[model samples]
Target: MLLMGVERFPTTADPHGEPAPGHTDWPRLPFVPGLMSRLDLAYKRVGYEVLSVAEPDRRAVMLHSDAAVHSSTTRIVHALSHGTPAADLSRSPAAAGQEHVHMVPACATLGTGTDVSQWVRIAHQQAQPTLFVIDLCRAGRSARLSELTRVPDGELNAWVIAATSPDRPAYDGRFSEAVAEVLEQIADHGLDTSPSIRFVRWDRVTRAIQNSLEGLGSSQRIHTTRVDVSQELPELPFFPNPRWRPGTRLEKLHDVVPPVRAFVADLGAEHFMDRVDDHFVGRQSQLHWLAAWLDDDRVGGLRVVTGAPGSGKSALLGALVCSGHEAVIDAAPDIRAYLSAQSPEGVCSPNPLLAAIHSRGRDIDAVMTSIALQWRLPSEPERRWSVADLISEAGTLPAVPALVFDALDEAEDPDDLMKSLLIPLAGAVRPDGRSLVRLLVGTRRWPAGPLLTLAGRDGGLLDLDDVPVEEIRSDLRSHMLRRLSSLPQYIPPEQRPIRTALAETVAEALTEETDRMHEWGPFLVARIFGHVLATQPVPDNVDAAVARGRTVPRSLPDVLELDLDRRPDGKDLRAVLAAVAFAKGDGFPTEAVAAVAPEFAPTPNVAAGCSLARATDQDLLQHVRGLLDAGSFYLRTGVETDGSTLYRLFHQGLADYLQAHPYPLDSATRSEAI
Candidate 1:
């Protein structure tokens, strides 16, 4: 880690000893020294080697003057852009290795000694996973440096966090102080008690800093760039949780099984949904019904939320978990009084046990083990716990425990999961004729077994298909507007108005198309058309953009098929998607994708007018990277062990589509791909 603090800058002279124009001698922020000290101690406590180049450290290169600061900044950029040699490492604290963090707390202005352009230029040639925490005025503008340099997003490997937006000024010392406070809090008190999450992610850290700044009465908003690509920076041991023990009873559950990280990172889950929490609108009636059901002491069986493909079932469940039951009621004042009257104590458990079946699918054993661990059931080495054991354990707790499971149809054996775990847990009853546990499940279709019988008897099913057409349309439009505004391409304040108008126009067109065609729903329309509109150039007239939006296909599969047929590299893209869909375990690594894509490539022939050349390994890799950078609707990304990229289909729906309409390949080519 490299820490640089500049509280003051020279006004009269530049680094070259020339007369500096439009440069002001920034006032010294006394709190900077203390902030750096706190950070140094906090990082050391969390087992990071502390390297400081800030104030009052005479042994290291000091930022005492403009020339020194400028020279140091240039050297740091050189080390990051090029390879760091022994000389560079010895002269400066910045290291050119993977997972290095560079933090600067200074007054940055254009044409000043502390200008950040040189630091931002490092993104042009960054080859490792690097993080930059810029605490200065207009720090967020550093992200635009890539645009100015014409560097593509996939080529850049740097993650940035700025104290304020591009057109705003930051309150001196507040951002740095917030960072120190958050790091200290994580080091002293762990971020979460769940053993499934072993580290405090960078996204969580940014939220904590924002909350701290808000408490200090600062209106400045922090901006982050390339967040999705490097959101797992903390998993690089950026900040290890002090409370995570390796051999605890809960930890043993994940010993042979894969970690639930993929489910946690799902687009509909808490981590990703939290980014768009404000955009979540509508679903009040559904939420109200769920709230009433959760609070009712008379009910304890399963409450399945069923919907067709592209329906917003996942989003609704995700919102419920992100915002607790009370927040839901508080958002709807009319329903709050009635809900409070029904349950005076409260509507639901404060923190429910939440889990989603992995997209690749989890077995019955893994499913039961996860539930048992979350309930804090004691692990017995000699005996394996069953569904009955979990039910009995829940009855002993002071309050009833709620178990929320999503994507039940995505399980390895849906029938086994329904029969072995969910069915029994739903029917478990206490001695007083009350339900032992509260169960909620989300699935694309109803299971064909005893689970259906339970739902029929209890009347606990909430079918999203039954939602009014107008309500669904309104909710989807709201979702599209929110999604458009949050795209990284249009995040700057200057681009907001144009994107807003375009979002409104596009949302209207897509919602109208959905009305004409009954199959399309919220998930498909928002994802498909949102990506389509975001990638297109902004029109000079909002009215003109509406015409362009009307040109989109009427159905999800048609849009996907159109994309496959139109692109120049369509065949190669399909090959990569197939590889990801058929991949075992988590997903396919970039190296594996590159190796397998060529086998599925088209054969050269003159009769069919096949003019495209065979792609090399480098070409294949670059193609995949470009797709990810362009925000392909079909692909999702993960990090490999060496910090490279991994690729997977965005959801099971896409995989299903690909399976139904597979690309043809010759027998020899198909065998090689297999």
Candidate 2:
């Protein structure tokens, strides 16, 4: 991760100090800000420590050392390991800078007017054989990479990997970024996925780097050479090779507890097609800002993210929470987990704080006991499990935990949540005297009055709808293609094999519709896949289909009406859906729903216009299940503590729709309300 910044910097000086002539500040220059840190992050992402390194203002600073060290390291050799400990030595900065010391045909390209012999001498001084990846300009005037530096006989041979042979400029993190990706790719695939070679040998890294360029969308080619009998690098992994076990990395894996794993896995990224073609595409700036904010020593509190339906709010939050992803976003160092009321898998609870705590593998019963003991809830033992009680308990947590509350507006008790869980959690204090929690909540803007009180001045609001639409268009396009490509592998080859041409057509149409209509979201794309797939003779007119699809009303009343049209007994389906949609807490008990649903006296010839002799609750339920499976409606079904299946819709939009357009129920419902 060490970056030897080659750029010039401005070092402020008193005009009378007579800095390098009119050059106030020595034309002072240092490494790129965050560049070295990013490279370190790259290796750390793969569970390696490249050691002490970089950003201009970061931990490692390469001050204006003498140029003499470039060609001759005898006097000023201490520059290499100044800030960094002896155990950690950098490989990139020096490598990239080495090119500047080489000879060109007539004149050197940006050289210090010295040969690379000094650098060669320094390479042999490393504690272990080092892998030196030099960034050499491939411009027509440059010499061959191998010719630039020659090692003296009897010295230890170091591995040299060169980003050369083709013309290219070394910009911010160019070679470093590509190198990071290459190592990560190799690590992910494991040595078995690669061609047979010694896993820890230089040959493996060389081949993998070259092969990785294609996947990285890079034209840069890297060449490698081994000077002699170099030792192996234990960092290279081989899944099948039992003999080559990863050290320290295994301990790191165990440190990530099961509860932590569950919390992250539940995030959308670890599941579905998200792991493959994740399209959190346009929110890098937001993510980076969030990462910096989260990791900032000066700030710690709630970060609220809101968006209209289909704005990809959940996906963005999920990316930040999932494992391996935290590094990409530079999240807080100690993120226990991220919990959302509206998990992509539809797993939720009425008491989200409780759910989140339990998701982290914390003992909810114990947490409740501790809170009850400390704060004294009502005399009744059962009342201690309430949202406020749990929130109080969260404040006494062992660590500065992070909790992500997604879709608060979708909570069964938004007001109760605001008063008990959210407000308290927002201002909670940890047992150790630190803040109670680091929270990121995603929800729609609603019941604005209460939310505003919680927001205060420190709160942040990121409205997905407020973001530039072009960015969302790109994300949706990528998501659509990824989803399209996943079908064949996910669906058994024996059934409904997708033709490449058909997939391309559908993807193009879906992307265009989502982008053109500005309606691309996870839900919309999923529904498109379902509806379009059902159509026979996959239509060639993608745009026309997309146009027709958008015409499917988004408004609740219109949507309910459209869903009703899908079945023959539209009235029965609609009534059942209305009951389920309006049920409280994901959905009240089935018996409760039946009590409120419209009922009719038994008719002798009920089979006359309808298929069923009489519409039993089971019949209506079967129809409801079809609607749920069709994506026309969004509902979650979970078992209650009493063992009955509770069905409710997590979508606040649908609930709003159901409220405005209540079914024409003939049942005695005024007294049967939940």
Candidate 3:
């Protein structure tokens, strides 16, 4: 891309035009050529395709410079744009539009020893580049009074007027010195990963840097702002909504059709589709309470909305977003405008969450930016403001809307999150001396104390137990009905009622002795239903089954016992069955089996103790044929106790039944078992 600079005059000695080599004082330029060269080189070095253009309208053409090329300009541009020092220069512009062309004459007066505003005017006029106005007066101390470490200065600028004055050393003297020092530091150290710079005083842009650097660097990001540190900033209302509506620019964009669909596809409609809840029923009363909390014309703070697991917290949050709150919907446009003003990039940051905040609009972006900045994610540039800084700076932002953070537990660190985020945000007073924000957080039980404290301190805590049971019931019934109705020849739409009844019956039966069935949530209810159907006889046994279903044993042994009692073969197979039962879980641990009923250990045929030997004589083998065919037991390999292995009851109920009811022994020696 071509990196073109639109200027009234040309610095290059054009091959096709007159060279003004002798017309200017080159020595007094303060290495002006070097500065410009540095910017060009640095931008190119960072992989930005660079090109120089005196007249952009003309196809970018190269001209050999009559004067020596200085690297200062390239380095300065690179530092300002990417927070990186100059490295290398690209031979040519890589592509066209990707080039970040810096407009010249930004501080021509500074280097030429002249006025400052002239450069600002020139820089401001250039539409293609981001404006950078430097003041050489900020070379040493800053306007604001603050302690700072020494650093080199990188940027060069002219001063039309004194940035500092005697009446306020805070604004002028020390401030300018501080600013200059910071620039010098940037020049010397290059850009470190940590953008930890902060500004304590607005007018002391120079000095504030000194004050802020006393802190440590952040591992995440850096935040900077246009907020005045010395004076209190006016609280700005949150920005208006950014949602596209009729006759709006977004509407026009959407009207184009293809792109709008593409945009929706990009937003991952499918991802949230299953999780989205449209009408989260049973929370109407709670909704009203939340609305009232938001309307407090008094001090603005935050509210904690909590519930048990599966209490539909996510659903409710979705519903709130759709329904539009007094603070959010009404003021969306204003918030959008504010965000647009702050970040023209439209929030497409590399960070997914940050990107979401950016694209949605400014009010959200501002809040997210503040959070990210506090984490040292570089809200603006090289450094981030602290929590105190954010609270102070929030004044400049648009309406601080009622912020909502759902699924608090899902955050990386809930404890740190509560203390750092919720605490300050909850206590944040408005610019007008009232609370600026009304924050809302949704989390499950096992409540964090900090969260509770926040709730106790001026904010209301509304338990979600009151969430309607009907909603859960509705969700379950709908799911079951949909599944049943899908059968072609079976379970017609009319039969959906029967399915629902069956589901409800099963649910009630399982949870009747427990708690409210709906309170168990859909997942747990489904598990209970699965147990009922797995062992219950289907279709033919429907009626007797419904009544006896509750009687259904809760484990495998119970099922086996019931099956054995109803069948004739089980009686004849008494000895084998008894022996199998005795050797229950994990093959009944051979030694323990010998102690309990040891006659079986010596021989398969047992006449003593539990009547195993006698039962074996009565065609027990004949009776056991069915069970053997059914894969219940296999022959004992190796020793009767050692390698013993066979099918045992799989469920707890079966093992419990067999263990609880021990067969009576007939002989004393046999009864003693081994």
In candidate 1, stretches whose alpha carbon ends up further than 4 angstroms from where it belongs are: 1-263, 268-281, 295-299, 324-349, 352-360, 381-383, 446-450, 487-520, 540-542, 563-568, 604-633, 638-646, 664-674
Clashes of 3: 83
Model 3 reaches what TM-score against the true structure? 0.32
TM-score of each: 0.53, 0.42, 0.32
* Candidate 1 minimal-lDDT segment of 10 residues: 77-86
Better of 2 and 3 by lDDT: 2
Candidate ranking under TM-score, highest first, comes to 1, 2, 3
Model 3 scores a C-alpha lDDT of 0.35
Give one digit per residue, the lDDT tens place, for model 2 in 1-674.
22343334335566666554322132222333344555555555545544432212221221222222222222211111111101111233344543333311111121232223334344446434333455434321122335433653234434455554434433333455566565554454332221222243445456656665555567666654533335333332211221233443322322332322222332332232223332234455566655555544333477777655555566556555542233211222222223221122221212112222112113344333433433333346445476555655655544344555555565445565556566766776665666666667676666434554465466476766666655654544444445444554424443233333344333344345544333334344434343344433433344544544344343234434554555455555455556666665335654555555453212325553442225464454343444344433344444333223456653445566566555533334422321
Overlapping backbone residue pairs in candidate 2 total 6
Model 1 TM-score? 0.53
Model 2 local distance difference test score: 0.42
Best model per lDDT: 1
